[model samples]
Target: MTNEDFTTFPIDAVSQERLAAQGLRLGLVDTSDAAAFDAWLRADLRGFHQGDPSEKVLKEQREGLAYRRTTGVWDETVDEPVVPVATVNSWPANLTVPGGRTVPAWAISSVTVAPTHRRRGVARAMLESELRTAAALGLPLAMLTVSESSIYGRYGFAPAALAADLVIDTKRARWTGPVPGGNVHFIPNERFVDEVAGVHERYRLSSPGELPVWPLRWQQLAGLTGDDEARKRGLRTLRYADEQGETRGVAIFKIDGGDADFTKHTLHLEHLLAETDDAYAALWRFVLEMDLVSEVRAGLRSVDEPLLWQIADFRGVKAEVQEHQYLRVLDVPVTLESRSYFSDGAITLGVTDDLGFATGVWRVEVANGAATVTETTDAPELTLTVNQLSSVLLGGVRPSTLLRASGSPVPDGMDALFASDRTPWLSVWY
Candidate 1:
């Protein structure tokens, strides 16, 4: 990292040189400066099809985005040299792995390149700069929830966790799961932030590939961050209390539809978090038994959901599996040792990385709920690309399926060895 020539984040010499060769300037955004920050923010929203930001939104966003390490790329020849053509935002987050442990991972987001700057290697330079920034921070992994799936594989990133979008016909579905001993109470929307005490943190640690939710994300979901329309449509919030009078879960939703046909309402779930099975069952039961809604649609849920068996009619519940979060491993030794392995044995594996951050054959030995990985010169029993290796890091991706997709033979016991007790599911998109 070099800072003599740049203003904000220490310049990545590699990206600086790459873009400089193509007649562009690579620099960082000083978020404290209002003009630069607003320009970057507008360009980001424009990339996602949102129009320019108003003064009200800008005032709110000035505080909301102050914590991010923002970067951008500039084209001086354009009419507006003050506004960047490309933008990237990053921060450090705790990535929960298997066995209730967490490792610090770099989270990258708000990546956008101007349409006028296509085919100029701008995206590649920006992505490489992000990876280098992560490596410089000594982080073991980098993660992002992608909007475009096709652009990241070449950069050595692959989906490590999967989620489901569920649509259930409330008329046909009946709750046959455990009769909850808990009672659900409707609370005012403003009290949600104070009431949700450690529920997401506890639930996050219990699952692999989950990350901590920031304060801004919570504010947006609770309709506190200037979401006037969500309030206008009637946002309902519920809190569940168990038989022992313990608060265990929270849900936020809105039942929205046209008034002409009132029976065809759809319950759009915004957020749902339950710390216990009883709380989960009770919350879901409450959703499924709503009086007005005929259909319930929930997105970013676990692929292996317990609700599958809870419904009386399987035909009513529809779940579509989709990859949600992607991971890129930087330090193989630190990452491999952070999570506990299920099977106790030794496996010599080879990892080939184009970025050269993690390209080596290592001997992985697991025993007594711990793992020991060391470099080995011996031939690898199984060979996997860098992304393929990242896919198996969370223990959600089946190695056999990946190998078969590439027309390669599968190795025995590999699936069971990397299988996790709880599935890796990320409910929040960072």
Candidate 2:
């Protein structure tokens, strides 16, 4: 169907049932069409909760858009810095509508489906559309903190990176190093827009799998927008720089009360970007040393985080590791070639994928960070489902690990398989 049709057509329950009766599949939303979709959204919102959303709520969405724009987290970046094309529900920069100018990215605020179309793949459609759009735009990955992990996996989304929490106890934290000297100067949120953007850009380029923060994400973080509510709820952002007037890293945290004795002071680290070991240590040390902050929590950390090695008391830090992200090599040869590999020798990989993304057996040749795939029905070296392939694609899981897993085929040069730059990390969730 045309974009106009997709946007304008009402997909109410009865309509969805009608489509089901005819056996039509879920399709893409026509993002180019604004009118029909806006109307549909208004109708959808009104019917979303079986009542009308007050002007206050609409005002919230708009303010949230402004807040999100400044934080560089929003997918779309506008001239005045508006929310990008693909976004789920977003919060205002502050609690008040039209409250501030800058918007920043924060948590996954909320999601909604128009009433005329419930359970008809609207959410999924929106999600895929957003991710694909981000990928096409070469934006840093999109992310959302999810309450339910299982829901987003189908679309290839993964868990948050940079894992930590405000729950960490500084008393237990053995101080590491003479804290690097840097004046903690608070600038007007707007003044640091360029500085914050520059720091994040440097971080993103170096971080192989880190998410990109649009200007809006920065806006939201700075609390420039009057609309953002979450920041009004007490989200705080900070920046650190060295004696050379160079911005080294940025942190977003929130202080929350905890236990009776401990008082439950918590700081959720949204982002910590560092170029040098000293930078990484300094940034973390600053957080640990925050006065009156009793606990710290961070999430979505790299498997080989330097914090583990830096800590004098290793046992003092608690880490619960889980699978972060799953990636499918859309174009096996290109995907492999895009990443670095440890081995210079060429090995033939007999690959099998049950997932429709890549199916049938194919031969993958790797050498010197270069890969080529050729269709072959011959006896393969590795025969595994798409999930296993996805897991191993990042080089995070060793080839040996895959072979150990049941149903994972070990082709001849199994050792040489997935010999790319340690495991690939999907550090960001989109």
Candidate 3:
């Protein structure tokens, strides 16, 4: 079916049929039925190898489920409580695109299938259902942070962004940046939910590949909820305000491993959000200069973090980069037209999709920093799979690089048109 026709496509029927053929039933979880949803959450957790969750944890999860669209697959042949063998959910979000525009996106998460259900197409059915639902709701893109890198590519999701894990030897490093004129102070953990949420909204709106941080995540970071014991141990929240006393940044971290030797203490950064450069630098300076802390470690950070350059000794900070967020275009024309382009040009893209959601040749034209995409009969200048297109859509991976690696045909100057000024980075995990 054409991309436009997919809006009315009966994906639910397809999902039901596919699962029924395997003697399974796909159904939505009733958010009000805490016991049923909790069982589903436990099954999902077990699929991920997590131990049984506590009652407190189950309650927290149930509360958060109120904000998400959740679905599950159950074995109808089994004569037991109808708990799901697989689970998937999506939250409504706005993804920041190029030129500071936000596009409505469905953020998919909690995708899990029990070991018993593996190889039974349970995950595929749920994923397909989620994508089709998003398309029907008029969302042009769907995104997720994957637990396994190799699993999503076949479904047309590609690594559109990257992040880094940073370990800084604070004892050996010196700050070389201009003295940040901001004041950093400790804030009560309870204030983190409201304070950081507001700051993050401002930050994510201007940052590419960023999505809105949900309320549950904010509470989890603030130590107000969740089952992570490591996050709560020695947890502290620090706020950075400009010299004018306007709060601009906040950091949640925990201090670990300083029993005998104070120098053995490590500051593990859980979440840090800054609205301005001065505030960012100020927070880093605060952490790097903290007493008794030997090293500072943070993960899921943008690969292009300026702190590496701000330090006098760059070698003291060890950084490991890894692929993070993946994006899939549900509608080729709408997805391309939604984002701003770097240069003015026209190219016919022959997009092949096994799922048939984004398959077709379309002419994508760019002019004056804007783009227009339309289906065309003209011969395509470049032919690639939907996964490859997604990889280069955010401008993180160059089309030329993929072409050279795969030995695929390349249109001249395609790299220039696709390259972004800044490397795309995703700082949060779903």
Candidate 4:
């Protein structure tokens, strides 16, 4: 660990003092210290209702997570500081926005408050501290993929991207899309984990709301490490190579056939990534046309997935859309300027933020697919809460939808002005 690893947030003081009154110590974890890191890891797992990790797993995770800014609330009064009653961690991630522009984002995750510590304000303290620290660091945005949807709106976060959980009836979905000239081959798990970043990098640039994934998550997806290794023992991975012999796509999946029905096996797709449209069509057809797999289940897919139209029967593809990534805007001007717009227009936007990070009126002008924003005293043609503005920021959720929900007078042309050619999607949870 370097000096950067030892850095602590100044925002911790408020939580520290508040928790101290109740005999709790809120502080950062010295990740280089093995014992402390292990205890925190165990508490985090228990908080999520998972089994205590083995020592081997603990060591592996401690090394993997050493670089993150980890914080926890310790109650030394009970059992004297072995484990914390609450845990949270954060790291910087590049958030891809509309028009292929990327902005630095503070990614928060691994938030947990033990059941025994309910209603103690531990979660509130940690969350507030995180937001304050992120803004202090000069970050323009704060993002998190939520476990419970209802917990974050009060904090000025709204769902900016929608993900689809899909179950395709392979027997009825025939290959109707173009037959791309690419060969699909079975690849080893180790190779896919090492090579996936390149494929994902290409895909992420054009897909708004995608975040840079951690190597640990890639290992989990490739079945390299997990508590349930036995369940992943049968994992199979596939890669697609274009005619020019480049690895353009990958799919990690497994077949479950314990139902005692020989022809009704289910193929579950753990992860699928394709860099090219050709690769996408080929890999999907390979999965849908697999032998003995009557059904396939995949999650965290784009809401506007092309597979929906690739199948012959539209009803064969059953996709359920769910809110995935919730984004909170910290700087309205920075956010509006980073992304490109669809229609050229000028309008005043008024943002109402209780947190006070993004409460202001700004005139947004769009021309030649770029936007320029500046503070203005002009009246707003449309007014939105901080969360509401965040929802439509990426254009995945239409501004008109929220405008209708608010029953507020919004200018008509603003809806088309904020539209995106591609839908926003987060490939994996941070």
Q: Against the true structure, whose lDDT is highest?
A: 4
Tens-digit lDDT track of model 4 for 107-208: 998899888887878888888888878877877889999988988898899999999999988878887998988799998888888668778977798988
How many backbone collisions does model 3 have?
0
Per-residue lDDT of candidate 2, residues 250-343 (tens digit): 6666777755645446777765656555567777887887776766787666767767655566666777766554333333444344445455
Clashes of each: 0, 82, 0, 0
User: Candidate 2 versus the native: TM-score?
Assistant: 0.66
CA lDDT for candidate 3:
0.83
Q: Assess the local accuracy of residue 96 in candidate 2 as a C-alpha lDDT between 0 and 100.
A: 7
lDDT of 3 by residue, 286-357 (tens): 888889898999988988899988887989999998899899988888778777778888888899999998
| lDDT-superior candidate, 3 or 4 | 4
Evaluated against the true structure, the overall lDDT of model 4 is 0.86
Full-model lDDT for every candidate:
0.85, 0.48, 0.83, 0.86
Q: Model 1 reaches what TM-score against the true structure?
A: 0.94
Report model 4's TM-score to 2 decimal places.
Answer: 0.96
